[model samples]
Structure formats: C-alpha cells, structure tokens
Target chain A: MDIVVKKIVREVKRGNQDAFAELVDLYKDKVFHIAYRMLGNAHEAQDVSQEAFLRAYTNIESYDENRKFSTWIFRIATNLSIDRIRRKKPDFHLEDQVSGTDNLDYHSQFAADIDLPEDQVVKLEMQQWIQDEIMALPPKYRSAIILKYLEDLSLKEISEVMNLPVATVKTRIHRGREALRKRLGQA
Target chain B: MACTRDKQQVINQYLDEEMTLLESKQFEEHLHSCPDCEKHVRELKKTTAIIQSASHFEAPKDFTAGVMDRLPKQSKTKRWQQWIRRHPIVLTAAVFFLVFVTSLSAGFGAEEEIVVRGDGHFIINESERTVVIPEGSAIQGDLFIRNGDVEVNGEVAGDITVVNGRHLQASSAQISGDIEEINQTFEWLWFEMKTLWNDAVPFLTPASEEE
Candidate 1:
C-alpha cells in the first residue's frame, strides 16, 4: 500500500491529475474524521476536509516524500480545523451531540471482534460519551487529545502537526485527559 | 494520605509512562500511600482508554469530486476575468482615477491665456502663467481663463471658469458665482469620484487584503 501511494505521489508530482484524485480519495475519510472530531460538526468537517485537499493540491510542490503523505495531509487538516474553530468561535454544549449520531451505528473491526453483543453495545456507548466530552473541550486541548487518541499519533508527531514542542503536547494531553476525567466522571 | 500538587503531577506523568525508572519507583511508593492519587490515576487511565476507542467518521461519497471541482483551474484568462467580475467597485474607481489623472496631465503643456473683464483689476505674469486678482478688485462679469492658471487674490462678483487650466484661491478671493473646472458634467463627476476614491483608498485597502 505504501509502495502504491508512493507511486501515485510520484505521478501526482509529474502533474497527473488522476493521481492526485486517487490520493485525495485515499485520505479523505481520515481527513474528514479528524476534522469532524476536532470541530464536532459534520458540515464544518466536510468543508475543512475539502479545503485541506485543495490546499494539498495547490501546495503539492512543497510536499516532501521522505515523510509519510498521511501525516502531511493530517497536519493540513489539523491546522484548517483549528483555524476554523478559532475564527467562528462556536458555543459548544455537552448536550448537543448532533454530529455524534452520524457514525454511531458504524462500528470498527475492533469493536466487531468483541465476543459478546451486550459488551459491544456498552463499548460503543462509552465511545460516544467520550466523544461528547472531547467536543466540549477548548480547541487547543481538544486538538491535542483527538490527535493523540484518534490518529494514534506519537507525541513527537503531534508536536510536528501542531508546531509545538513535545513537552507542550504532553502538557495539553495531560490537561485534556484531566478535563475529560472530571466531565465524564460526573456523568 | 492526601497528595501534594507536585506529587499529583508526578502521578499523571507516571500514568503516561513518561517518568524515568527511578522517578516511576518513587511515584509508585507515593501512590501506594495516597488513595486519592491512586483513584485519580485510575480515572485518568479510564479516560485515556475511552478516548482511544472513539470512532472515525466517513467522508461523503462525492467529497473527492467536490474538492476537484473547486480546485483552481489552470487557465489564466478565466482567472483574470473572474477577478475583474468580483471587484466592480475597485475596477470602476481605478478607471476613474486613471482618466482623471490623465486629463490633468494632458492639459499641463498648453499655451497660457488670461481674460480679465470689466472693473477687474489684475496683474498678468505671463512668464509664470499666472493671473492675480488684486485685493480690492471685484469683477462684475464672468472671468474665463483658457490654457492658463488663475490666482484669485481678490473678490470676483461673477463666474470664473478655467479651461484646461489650474485654479488657486487666496483668502481674499471670494467668488459670488460658481467656479468651474473640467467643465463637462461627467468629467466633474469623474473628478469628484476620483477624489473621493483617493480619500477612501487607504481605508479600503487593508480590509480587502484581510479577505
């Protein structure tokens, strides 16, 4: 898959429009998911995801193939989501989980691997509840927590995406986790 | 036992596995004695687990196509036309200012003439291309200057018109009638619009750049 992606990236660098389209198709879900989790709104997530692809297309010459393409695209999506959230200043309430309903029924392979049906349901509900708590967090803390968990990025990788020091990323994650503990524990 | 703030920070670091071996051992011993810190660590671990289990969202089926459609096309002429269409006010102001400045500069090198009418005592300095109306001099009829400049140092009871010429008014020069330059209606309108635009340019520029 890496080899195929690398080949497509090379073709894209050579100005093949179809290759770039293929690249967008490959990362669109990941980008959209990151944006959705960051923004807590599906429409805004879709907009940010589309914009991230457009930005990647325009700035393709600046992409360094030595690094993973996913990380680069994720970084662009992260920046756009952060900027959008900051600019709009949306009032996030814990009760408003409209975006949470979009994918609650769609479980991952890991969730399916669970032996018991009732346990899977509980796990899914817990996941949904955690997502609501994450949405209620401040943008910076929300970004750090989402990237650390959803993307499963290392602190160093998150630092690069956020353009912050690893120490700062760790601090954000710690604070974000503490906030979630307080909020979710109450519920 | 209750946990100190610094110890609580160490507990968080330990939970994240960021502590060194020695630090971890010390923090473990402290946590063993402090039930509050132990409970906090357990809750943090659960929080981390729940966050990691959060679901991924799927993009709409047409997302890629939509983005491709919105991408900047390679045609320069289309982009230029789009830009011109978007900023109608800016384009109009630019054209008006250009024409205004061009007309003013075109009239610069023309021959000088001064027409002083009845009871209008004036001094003509042909070398300077200037006609000075004296302090006490008051003109009854119209004073028309063509291809020259007028320095109104005294009162004019009648209309003063300058054609392809510049007008300078002093403190004593009060014209009872209208003073007209760039005589056509559209030309006056364009000139006024250009002046208004020039005054407004500084305020308009930063706002446009921000967008």
Candidate 2:
C-alpha cells in the first residue's frame, strides 16, 4: 500500500494530474474526520479538508519521502484545524442546560433537524454531549486525544502529527482521557 | 503497594496497553485489590469508546470532486512562471541564458559528429553525414547541424547553429543571418531544455480551453 501511494505521488510530481485524485480518495475521510472532530462543524471540516489536501498537493515536493505520507498529510490537516479553531472563537458555550440561550437553540435546532426516534435521539444527544466534552479540551490535548483514539494513531504517529516527543504525546493523551472522564462524570 | 497517585498514571498506560506483560499482571493484581483503580480504568475505557464510536464519519460523496475542482491549475506554461516566482535569481540567470542561447545555440554538447535538422531545403549526403546547401539554392528558416558538417553554398534566411560540427561556407554563400558554432555540456543541457519546451508547447492548451 505504501508503495502504491508513493507511486501515485511520483506520478503526480511528474505532472500526471489525474493521479492526485487517487491520493485524495485515499485520505479524504481521515482528513475530514480529523477536522470534523477538531472543529465540531462539518462545513468547516470540509473546507479544512480541501485546504489540507491543497496544501499537500502544492507542497508535495517538499514532503519528505522518508516520512509516512499519512503523517505528513495529517499534520497539515491538524495544524490547519487548530488554526481555524483559534480563529473562529467557538460561540456555542453549553455551560449547563439552563444557561446560554444560543446554546439551547443550537441543541433544540439540532434535535429538530434530525427527526430521529426517541431512543436514537437520546443516543445522539449523548453523542453530542460527548462531542462537546471533547471539543471543550484545549487544542493541544484535543489533537493528541483525537489522533490517538479517534483517528487510531499510535503514540509515535500522534507525536509525528503533533510534532512532539512520544513521551509528551503520551502525557497529553493521558491528560485528555482524564479530562474527558471527569467531564462525563465517570470519575 | 501502588498508591492511588502513582497507580493513577499507570491506569492510563494500562488502558492504552502500553505496559509490558509483567507490568500489566502486577497492575491487574493491584486493580483487583483496589476497587478505586478498577473503576477509574473502566471509566477511562468508556470515555475512549464514546469518542471513537460516537463520531466516526466519512467525507461527503462530492468530496473528491470538490477537491479536484479547487486544485490549482499548474499547467505547462505556469511551470516556468512558478519556478521564477520561487527562485528570483533563476529568472535573472534564465533571462541572460535565453538571450544568449536564442541569438546562437551556445550550449555545446559532446559528440562531434554530423547531425542536421531543419525545414530548410538542403542537399544531403547521408554517407558523409554532411548537409550541403547548393549554391544559389534558397534555404528557408533556421538550420541546426550537430556532430557533423554543413557546406552552406546557398541563401539562409535565419541563424545556422552547429553543435560539435564544422561549417564550410563558400565565398559566394549569401547568408542572411548569424552562424553560431557551439560545443558540449551547458549547451547540451540548453539543447535538451529547448527540445522539451518545444515538444510541450504544441500540446499546451489555454486554461480557459479546459473549461
């Protein structure tokens, strides 16, 4: 698989325009999911996905072949997601069920559009609550956690994506899990 | 006796299964004896499970197309422009080289044998690898002779560039333009680049044409 991906990348470098579509097809879901998980917005996630792939395509020559292509692309996506998160300044602050009218409106509107059965709605609400908890994390810990458990990246791969030491990534993942546990009242 | 503080750090590592076998056995033993650590580990598992399972999503169906549409059109013509934009010094040097090369194909290649290529009419002796322009014969456009000789005894309207070759022009040869003889290396590279550029130019379509 690595060889096939590398071959496609080579073809793209040689100006075979069609070859890049293959690469995009391969990593789009991963890139999109990372952005979605990070931003909690599908629209922004799609935008960030396109931007990450664009950056990767444009800078394909700069990509070091010695490193994994997934890592390189994920790093670009991760960094861009972080930048967007910081820039947007998330407005939905769901402090509690009583506070923040905009927040409750978002939740209610979220429920209305789905139109799921009762149990499914309850499940989705739980999922949304968990998503909110994940989003509440600081970007640094959020990236580590998302990459590790959400994206299923190993500690070393997470470190490569975050460009941190493996030990540092481990600590961040530990902290992120602990944070989530506390937020969900599991502790 | 693993206290709650030290065991707290171990709980995460244990959940991630980062601990070695013996270490895990010892932690499991500690967990069985300690209900607090066991509950903490279980909750951590629940948290990770919710994160992984709750939000698994794929990109929209039009994702690949959207990415392709937004792709920058780095076409053939844009290649040199992009290069120049990146390396300003290359632009200056390229301008100098182009001016120097266009006037006369100065990038000389090795192989000093006769090779002639052009649309201009010329008398050719294949065995000798020598191109002869018969006296009073009108030769149109540029002529390139490489690795051999050219006997120009006719009228040439443009430059005659010879690479690693000889030119024997008769006294009566009415040449309308400069004749340049370049030999080996940088000239070879320039020759290759020119060939590549010429080949690509014919297939190059305007960006608007693609749409």
Worst 10-residue stretch by lDDT in candidate 1 chain A? Answer: A103-112
Misplaced by over 4 Å in model 2 are A94-114, A185-187, B1-3, B76-211
Per-residue lDDT of model 2, residues B104-173, tens digit only: 5433434334567776678778678688998878767778887668899888877788877778999989
Alpha-carbon shift of residue B198 in model 1 (angstroms): 86
TM-score of each: 0.56, 0.62
If candidate 2 were superposed on the true structure by all CA atoms, what would the RMSD be? 15.4
lDDT of 1 by residue, A41-85 (tens): 889999999999999988988998888888899899999998998
Model 1 spans > 4 angstroms off: A1-3, A92-128, B20-26, B74-211
Pairs that clash in candidate 1: none
Most lDDT-accurate candidate: 2
Worst 10 residues of 1 chain B by lDDT: B107-116
Per residue, candidate 2 scores C-alpha lDDT tens digits across A1-187 of 8999989898788766668999999999999999998998899999999999999989999988778999999999999999998898547543445454544533454444646799988888887887888889999999998898888888888888899999999889888878888876452
